[model samples]
Target: MILERIIPTVLSVRRILRADPALVKAYGGDPEKHTSLGLVTCDQDDAMYVALDEATKHAQVDVIFARSFYAGAAHASGRLSGEILGVIGATEPEAIENGLDALLRCLEHDACFYDADGKRTVTVFPHVIASLGEYLSKEAGLAPGTPMAYLVAPPIEATIGLDAALKAAEVRAVRVQPPPTETNFACAWLTGDLDACEAAAVAYAAAVVDVAAQPRR
Candidate 1:
């Protein structure tokens, strides 16, 4: 029987940013500070996060092979074709066409997996495609084309160490005072992962609730 793929919707604490207080006071009264932002998982599995963390830790990474149509056409010169032509010139055209098609697929796959920010961005992996298209349009001096879609394998390693560190640390959530408007983002300092992290949040909230419930000691 074929095993079903398991994907988890992850909520990471990394995306959160701090907010300003003076502005809050100006508008009303006390500014509630927030340190971290919760990131909703784009997919079902934490494999992508684990994989990205692994790739970041390891050096000498393996090169994933991808063949672009343009790259394949450039490489398919008479010299390279000559060897195959000698064996089967009568059917050379068909073989060359097939090779070109395969090359296009390879290029498309590579384009999909191309990522710059590693784990931080891997959670929002699909966004990379749009980001790439925008980048390529500017670099290539051409109008942006509709974005292409592709799948990426999560990193081959797990991030057990990072997980352990987050669990062990006592992080305070704080809002940042604004220097720039863009700097004014909301954030929190909770652990990663949906279940464990959320459970921790619930536990913390329960403790707070319990404290409030107690009469003045």
Candidate 2:
């Protein structure tokens, strides 16, 4: 097996393994051993396909998941830029690195970006997963009857809106989903007392207008 039997899931189907990890069980093995997740961006769809093909040929790694143009926007020149986000698992750390090197070489001279986060080296799973659990929890630690507000704006104003909301009141920044294109809008979630939520909403609205008036990058 190319993956060297990393994790054993209850379901005996490949499709089920990719959809949700919550159902998967570790068979006396590390769930994230020698695993890496990456985001690759390219302006053309053809380039993305070629890169994925070459990367697999060069290294003994399992392509856990892949999706093209998942969060990419159209170019200003009216061309569709493509993005591929996927996870690679290997028996050894060197194998994963070799695979990334090969992938980059295949993408040489192309206007693309490669971002890989090595799970073994830098660990953020505990904090991230905990935050998610808290956010999704029914008894969400907040004061009873507290309200939540969502601020929606274009991508450009995402940072500004978050900053404005925090400065406006004592509110918990629940989440921020940035926009992928002009057609998509950035959304921020805030939770706090009723009066603070109202203030945060106004602040976010003002931030959105301010960003909209600025020159586009």
Q: Which lDDT tens digits does candidate 1 get at residues 10-92?
A: 22211213324553244332345222111222122212222221221222111111111222112434332210110000112
Query: Residue 136 CA error for candidate 1 (Å)?
Result: 26
Residue range 1-217, candidate 2, lDDT tens digits: 1111112111111112222233122212224543333334444332343344445566775554444453333432323223333344455656666666655664553312211122211101000110211112222344323466545544666567678888989888766667652334465667877678778866765665555455364
* Model 1 ranges with Cα > 4 A deviation: 1-188, 215-217
For candidate 2, the 10 contiguous residues with the lowest summed lDDT are 121-130
Model 2 residue pairs with clashes: none
Residue 133 Cα positional deviation in candidate 2, in Å, after optimal superposition: 18
Q: Best candidate, lDDT-wise?
A: 2
Best by TM-score: 2
Distance from true position, residue 94, model 1, in Å? 47
lDDT of 1 at 185: 15
**Model 1, C-alpha of 119: deviation from truth (Å):** 42
